[model samples]
Target: MTAGTKPVGTKTADAVVIGGGIMGASAAHFLARRGFGRVVLLEKGRLAGVSTGHSAAIVRTYYSNSITLELAKRALHMFENDRDLLGGDCGFRPIGFLLLIGERLRAAGEHILESERRHGLHVERLAVENVAELAPPLSLDGVSYGILEPRSGYADPTRTTENLVAAARPWGLEPRAGVAATGIRLHGNQAVAVETEDGTISTNVVVNAAGPWAGQVGAWLGLRYSLRWSRESDLLVEKPADFGELPVVSDPGLRVYLRPCGEDRIIAGLGAPKDIEPVDPDDCDPGLDPEMRERIERPLFERLPALSRARHLGGYASLYTITDDWHPIVGPEPGLEGYYAFFGGSGHGFKLGPPIGEALADVICGETPEIDLAPFRPGRFIDGEPLTSAWGEGNRG
Candidate 1:
């Protein structure tokens, strides 16, 4: 049977989540686990086929704000305990993460160190020598120091989304792949159902986790979200035979972040705090551009000199649905009773989606979430309380 076509004659559901990316899958999983009967997840395409699939799924807890730091910390826990918390193995690699601190980023790094420590997160301040000892492949030319998260690493985005949905299947979670939500049916000012190309499913609760297409989804309900789209890319190169294992490295000085993709390949991308390359989410090129490849590789070669002799293995591009504050807009929409806004991850949504979804599920069930999500309220933008970041105007929150 096609996804979401189960229980034979059911045309109704307790909740409907739009977009099958990590955010949507996560929301559906938690809602179903909470015993919200008949939770349906609607996807225009395959699960994690859009932005989530293309993400360089790095999971870390380094942030300047308490809300994000808490959310990220929860995410790390969920990933580490995936079988129990997330329903299955999420392909989490505990390869550690290293943030190279240079003169320009020392102050921000220090702030992150202080914030993370205050939250009781496991973080260490490593000097230049310590960094070199941790990753012998790195050059550390302009690096002043480093911040290390020993448990932070990357995960398989597609696998993570699939696992969440699979874990929730027994609890009445219906995943509707290849189904596009065209509009939201509202009674007065509240969402009542969702209209899709296949058919409409009557539901009281609706969560918008549409990633790059989120702005368009908001318009269906007369809601206007200030979202911008950027084309982000990541490239992989064949790892040298004797290069050995390396931790996920984020170098603000070189403006690049890289990690081991697998046993024989390394993946790299431009770090946050860079210029946003605006794009039409539907029309943006999925293949990495030649110029961008050069830009990403130049820094990769500088950091790990051995990679210069490695072969280019091509790369792909994807979209980052950005908000003005570089943070996700979560929680219930103000005037809409059963509608929730859960998109706009900026650039770091992959790692934050599941934990935020779990907390959002708690909020929807009229219970208090372990991590308060008040800071990410949808109306924060209009209230003139946009979140500030150490690296201003970038996705380094």
Candidate 2:
């Protein structure tokens, strides 16, 4: 784990993780607990120092795909009571989430509601009056309907990742920070170890959980994928001097979402046509401009008239690795034995980390996963399969 030491002969491990964010940390945690004792987790920087630290930490199960929805539901179950699985405080907040829909998507709203009900999600379809009664802040004149998830909420992504790493340490896993993966060592077309910037660690398998930089990692093994990175800025506005409780809210028509960070601050983000390519993952600006704020503020003001009283403190950029359909790229990579890639989660990975890690671990051990992973195969694109879906949030397959 030394920063500048010469590469040493690595002690073989059962599995090696290439990133230290929530995905890698949770994967390592599950692998060790599932009887994979020789596990090593490598982080290019400190654990949760990059995208995971800046995550909006929204936890919702409104996915259009059944596999992903099941994964989110399972992970939520673990997070809802982390004391049993993670063995410490994971900072899970139970604040509700309200998703506003426009007139054009009323059918989509009902379809999602019915699907949630079938899965026992307990979500309710709300009229404008019900929306106002639940949130009591937003202007609902333009909204046709809304969905209320009483069990959905947010969490502190950084703390959750660190807590998982801490829990795995006792199970004989080593999480080494400040080590960057430069390449992969292959034996008979299967990854056997990862060569880092400083040293090489020999292992039985490698898990590509690199978050925003996952595509670069995939290239190391010559596995072609469609993962691409983009930057979205969010304005963290300080609450007004007398601001009251504001639940986490999403407006699909406006492509914007906001949530209360604490008693005195609110976090806001948008997915719009103005999205831009990210320049650098580490140095991207975290501040939002007046024009961008206004773009988000206009719809927000209509939804929450009370937010007009708050002051904009600043904004920051969070990187997203989007695929053609925005569904996560999990499971094994095509033509690469002994390796699994998990990234391009779009913006939903934080809440799905626990289940993703568990599924990856199950694959490594030759066990059938609890949830079907047909929707996340890397070969989907090669076989002329479209990454098409109801939600147009495209990501690497």
Candidate 3:
């Protein structure tokens, strides 16, 4: 229907990427660039029109683990080179990233800081007083220390995803929008084709980048992916004129993330809270509710007093496909050939999409990913090796 999608049925592809979100589009782009043939991407709606469209789209590498940190770090590179390498402007703004932790998480934050330093990243462990220099008119009443990554910032999610689809076009990626993948056609254990509403596309490989709908896709193959959905909401308000510019701040102590929305607005959201509201991905209304608005305003006001004077702007709610360990499940599914599980973003899907997509594409092509993906394999959960984190943080993957 939309000019972006193709009528399926008779078409066959070397690999079929489901979901047109950042994950799927990123995977398709990398797969086609890697010389995979006839890569067709299927999306039920418009590109990046689901959760990715609603994502705050923060890009940072402050992780509690090395694996995700590596992925996030590489993602920054891809975003930086989007125009030359990824085929379009990703709208990446390298303002900065700030992480605030209380006394309870100081030791854990320091541990992660050490790992970041070991990886040769430029980060600084700042005392509480220094936090004021990054975000002015803020409260550090309960904060103990902060970690700053000046090279990290945010991107436009919809543009980045659409650019990925565009980038893959010349490389033979056929993205079919408004076409839902009904099921997976399997021959024995090998995924042979994807059954779509338009028709069947014969394929050997499939990437489940369905975000909140990934759990449903996994069921088609008789695979039970340990996935959960949470309603995450974010709000934007007119930035106080004097606020000028501010670093993207993630305060676990306040359970909020604050970032600049262009030059005139500020965006705020609850950061990796454990009291996740389980919701049905297909049925729930994804809109920021009044109760949630109050929940966000309290800390946001206390953290940045100047923001309270800004005009209130609208905001939205979206789904976070969370896994038990709060990290994503990327890699081949056990006993399922040519099928890779690539969802379960927990909450950090935005920045990790490109790198994880590249790595998963490598795994599917029988090449060693620059980074080992064994730690993110789905089998780890069953093997009792669920990826754990320092401080037991929720979304600081």
Candidate 3, residue 281: the lDDT equals: 89
Q: Can you give the TM-score per candidate against the true fold?
A: 0.97, 0.92, 0.95
**Quality of model 3 by C-alpha lDDT:** 0.85
Best by TM-score: 1
- 303-329: candidate 3 lDDT, tens digit per residue: 887778789898888888888888888
- Per-model CA lDDT versus the true structure: 0.91, 0.77, 0.85
List RMSD in Å for every model shown: 3.5, 3.5, 3.8
lDDT ranking, high to low: 1, 3, 2
TM-score of structure candidate 1: 0.97
TM-score for predicted model 2 compared with the true structure: 0.92
Which predicted model would earn the best lDDT? 1
Over 4 Å off in model 2, which ranges? 1-8, 271-283, 393-397
What is the number of residue pairs that collide in model 3? 0
In candidate 1 the C-alpha lDDT for residue 297 amounts to 86
> What tens-digit string does per-residue lDDT give for candidate 2 at 319-387?
776776676778887677889887776777788888888888888888988887667777776677645
